[model samples]
Target chain A: MGNVAYAVLSSDEQEVSIMEKKIQWETELVHALQRSKVEKRPILLDFHNPH
Target chain B: MDTVTYPQQSVVTFIEHNLIPLRVGSDTQPLASDFAVTWTPTLVLLDPQGKEHHRTVGFFDAEALIPSLLLGLGKVEYDSNKFKEALGYLEKLLAEYPESDSAPEAIFLTGVNRYKSTGNPLPLKEAYEQLQRMYPASTWTKRAYPYRLLG
Candidate 1:
């Protein structure tokens, strides 16, 4: 697969993130998205999440 | 500006080349103001219409930028606990690495995130105050005045 750069845009944090691959970014993105759902708005990404 | 493209090469080489997708201007003022990009190495996420979606300024590496990017994309929602986790790290960066170029911006950004996600004005106020007190001359401070933390 071609190298994919995954970018996530969060409104609450007003921040953007990019990772080298979709798998890597998506894995982390899911955790963060779920957290955002819980928190009731978008928050900063926990970029260091191991999963 | 209408479309986005990523020219994939060796990641390390691409990092070396620093080929950002957006067409950045030579002058720092516009980028800093319109997009909230206050630091040199910023990753700005523009909407398809080219409006600012979210921006990560001065993150040292992808590790620091990716999660923030996810948040910007609307793929992630807010989590107070998670925000706290990120805030902890940012605070650590400030306390442990005061000399780091990204420290001040991190503080301000964290405050911005806190406000947006949790509607907490106090931390955002602290962030503005921090820049004013410690780095009064910081570019972020210049942009901070109009921001009234309280509704």
Candidate 2:
């Protein structure tokens, strides 16, 4: 059931819930693909210009 | 996208439910050079092996984004030869977001997915007809022009 990996943004339980409600973005492509394979889900890779 | 699209509740939920979201700076490392990042907000869908199935360069609002991602997921399944699974995603996109920018392409792929799964060319012809009737000016309609002769 717990197949998807969540990126923990905060340690607080309340903050964790709030974070979970948002898109959990993984920073590393390698890590993202690893989770993707395990979950059998595709990866939505967004390359944004931070400027 | 950060300021507008991604923050939308529907977009967040859709993405969280179906995809592994990865965010990276365009200028970030080997990936930038590998994927050829010459622009901002380039969204690419990759299989777990890092094979790209679909890509959209530039911006897409929440309405457009959902269908595009659905098409990508369908493409991923199509590429993997999972025709039934591909149809599931493509059909959902067409049924839910038929007026979206991604709809024409979804229709085109839905036809192809149907043909591949059933070994029937009739679906391809029907796809062309549907595209002609629904989106006569779409590029997908043009792309499926040859499919019109499939019957």
For every prediction, compared with the true complex, DockQ reads 0.03, 0.56
Which candidate ranks first by lDDT, i.e. highest? 2
Off by over 4 Å in 1: A1-51, B1-81, B148-151
Writing each residue's lDDT as its tens digit, candidate 2 over B1-151 gives: 8878988889999999999999999999899999988998899999999999999998999999999999999999999999999999999999999999999999999899899889999999999999999999999999999998887
RMSD for each of the candidates: 15.2, 8.0
TM-score of chain B of 2: 0.97
| Candidate 1, residue B149: how far the Cα is off, in Å | 6.6
Please list the C-alpha lDDT of all candidates, in the order they appear. 0.47, 0.92
Model 2 per-residue lDDT at B144: 96
Q: Which stretches of candidate 2 lie over 4 Å from their true place?
A: A1-20
Compared with the true structure, what per-residue lDDT tens digits does model 1 show for residues B1-102?
Answer: 011222232323432332123334324444346554444455544332334445554434433333344334431212323565556556655665565555
User: How well does model 1 score by local distance difference test?
Assistant: 0.47
Interface root mean square deviation per prediction: 13.3, 1.3
Per-residue alpha-carbon lDDT of candidate 2 for residues A1-51, written as tens digits (9 for 90 to 100):
479877755569767566646788999988998999999989999999877
TM-score of 1: 0.36
